[model samples]
Target: MSPTGERVAMATDELQATLPPAVTVYERSVYSDGDSTFALVNDADGKRRLYVAGPAIADFDGGTVQGDGQVFPLTYGNAMALAEVFPWLEPTTAGRQSAFGFGDRIGLATPGHVRAVRDSDLVPVFAQQSIREMDRTGRSPEDVLATAIFGVFQEGYEGGFVADADHLMAREDVERTAGVGFTMFTCDPSEHVVADADSMSEEKVEAAFAQIEDSEAILDRYAGETFEAKTDGFTWSDSFSEIELKRAAVKYYEAIEFAEELYGWVAQAVDGDFDFEVSVDETETPTTHLEHALIASELDRRGVEVTSLAPRFVGSLEKGIDYIGDLNEFEADLKGHVAIAETYGPYRLSLHSGSDKFSIYPFFEEYASDYQHVKTAGTSYLEAIRVVAENDPDLYREIHAFALERFDEDKATYHVNTDLSNVPDIDDLTDDEFPKILDQDDGRQLLHITYGSVLSATDENGEFRFKDDLLGTLREYEDDHYAFLEEHLGHHVDLLTGEIED
Candidate 1:
């Protein structure tokens, strides 16, 4: 029941005076919900807790009451309860806007992400994590989503955000994130995408196509058919021959079928509306024009409402670095992909591994400005590590050296091409120069893919080797961390929104 009163809230300074001596209240976080005033506070121990003050203290359950109200630990349950009081605390959909997924591996980066996104027109998916990331960081889907909610609360950001269950490959993955209230589900069907179809002979392609369910129906529908689409500034037209149709079918039939299945599972898992994104960008081969059109067509035909689709563009979109390929070719390829999205479903064209690709931002904005979603994961973490290198050189040295040792083993899951020999020896550098390694491509990627090892590393006693120190440093110097992310990620938003200076 909503409290009936003139909604009362204590001033930040007043609230801080009433709380414990060491407890500091977040100024922005102080707000009135019903008759009770709620704020997120950090104690001297660096633990964040929820502080509620008002006569309706009993209505706000949990925690010990000090002067006027209770101080509750920022647990998942508390966050959920707070979200009930304020609907804005929950994640929402980005809809048809150009969204950006800022994947926070450590969960402390969303406030910085929020600061960057708030100044731009793009929608923000603040809570995004893959099953692989969850496994590596030992974070539950609940952990990821809750941390994002907490961060959003601490920053007092009322702007809507999307919670993405990113790169989900199985029904369980979708169910898990959906159960935790994710608003978007990205279906990754790369494993099912047959890359060999691109190089197969006509006979081999035909044989492979015969194995597809409803192969005759697919052939009758798309074979020898002319497809055309009009994009923002370009027209795309393509006619598929029987051989080409078979090749496309053999390549993406399974992936499309899997996407359809995943879509159904997502719909069933969620109680209400949820956005769905199909991602085939992680495969070995780039998605061709025909393949993209065919995949979109098939998913649409299967009644899957794809909100966005990440087609593998014609370039090397490697992790934690700039785009690697010819600009002209990429632009030309992107035009067709954008056209396919417009023609089939008008869904956003998502770019996975999208961060730090400063060179391609202009092209994306030019062609798919109104229908694009740029996702960035490791770059934010890299920015945090930069904070460490600048503040605690010894810790940065330890992490960099540990990353070098774990690079080969951890690199198995990623598609990076960083040569360790190219990385500068950190020992030779002065303490002040430690942050420069984050600037070089090889050095950036060397630390990017090995985040799991670095974060999860434990000592002989099973205590965290670097996680505590890393987190503590970031929290203690959050202003600096937020500034770095704001400037760095803000540049990305600026470029994508055409806010860049000449």
Candidate 2:
């Protein structure tokens, strides 16, 4: 019995005499609400008891006692109370070991993927097979496939994969990608082709203007007829004499109209929901710059808010010192973009291809404090492979080969060339060649090294070179990546949202 008057034990000599020495017994006072109503006697005799206070205290009452001394109704709460009173009464620790292994060790990238995996009840093999099938068919719906692929993680996942239309030069492509459910897009006005008055002679300028005027005139002439035909629901059973000319005029007008419509549509689509980015190519021709300004003005006139404006000021130059020139140029262009973003209200100025340029962090911090977003992608992924490769050469080689094959395929599809003169040639080279290659040019070196590292980390078959090592390496990389961002780029990224720490 406890010092508080709770019964602690009951004498059972006869049961103890026949039972093994390991067997023991005890008694405990149990309560209900505020009433001390029963005494719990536990023994090898299987809880034989005596009733002392309730109405049926004299009878066993089917092994249940009703009096104050009787123990009645072994409810779950009572069972817990009994266990608390006597620790040995509970199940053994050995019996409580987890039935299934791998508890709480796994982590996920987002929450949405977790729900998808849980709801679908998919295992890793199933998820991998689904991704494989998706890759083969290229028909996976954006949301569904993103969820399935990312759902393999056990924690820190939110459903869906996010991809940005990195640089889109045409309104049609923007609308097309958006229709396919791409939420992030970049519209680059610097790619617009514009007439260059400075580069061309006066006669050439006049001729170009004349051609434009003639085209507009031809369009105006048949514009009324085409509108009338369309409004009247006219159907053509055979080719008409002026059909081609009229069609061209209609197409030209529609293209212009599409541009205006697209500005409004993208603005509405991105408002308060997703990031709509615009990039200005500082290296573009003067005419293209002017055209982009016109587009921005049109967007402003249409009441469409610009969210972010990125300027590509740096190029693949040969010298590290040349980056200083690039920086100066970037600063000049950044001012214009900043002015635009500030005037538009809530818009930010961003930098693109922000990789391997760790030296530019201070510059970004100084100028882009008010900006809303900053993005860096390929750098961290490259660093991830590098870390894994340091520990395992074979795995590194596999990943490297895979990345190279994938990149080669991408290059082929996109018609990208390495500009052999810009890269090092090691054929029949001396020992001095390696150092020369490393010291050649910072910009080119960064590009080559990043690409080479990525290629080296992948396998020949275009698979992730270290598929088996992905989880551990990814975790380590994610940790280091976040730390890097916090230490170096955190000022630009939003600490709360983790989106460019704006």
TM-score of model number 1: 0.96
Task: Give lDDT tens digits, candidate 2, residues 88-189.
Answer: 222221111101000010122222223323222111111111122223223232432233222221122222223344455555555644553444555554
Residue lDDT tens for model 1, 301-345: 889999999998987999999999999999899989988898899
lDDT (Cα, 0-100) at 500 in candidate 2: 37
- Pick by lDDT: which candidate is best? 1
RMSD vs true structure, all candidates? 2.2, 21.2
TM-score of model 2 (CA atoms): 0.44
Candidates' C-alpha lDDT = 0.87, 0.36
TM-score on alpha carbons, each prediction: 0.96, 0.44
Clashing residue pairs in candidate 1 are: none
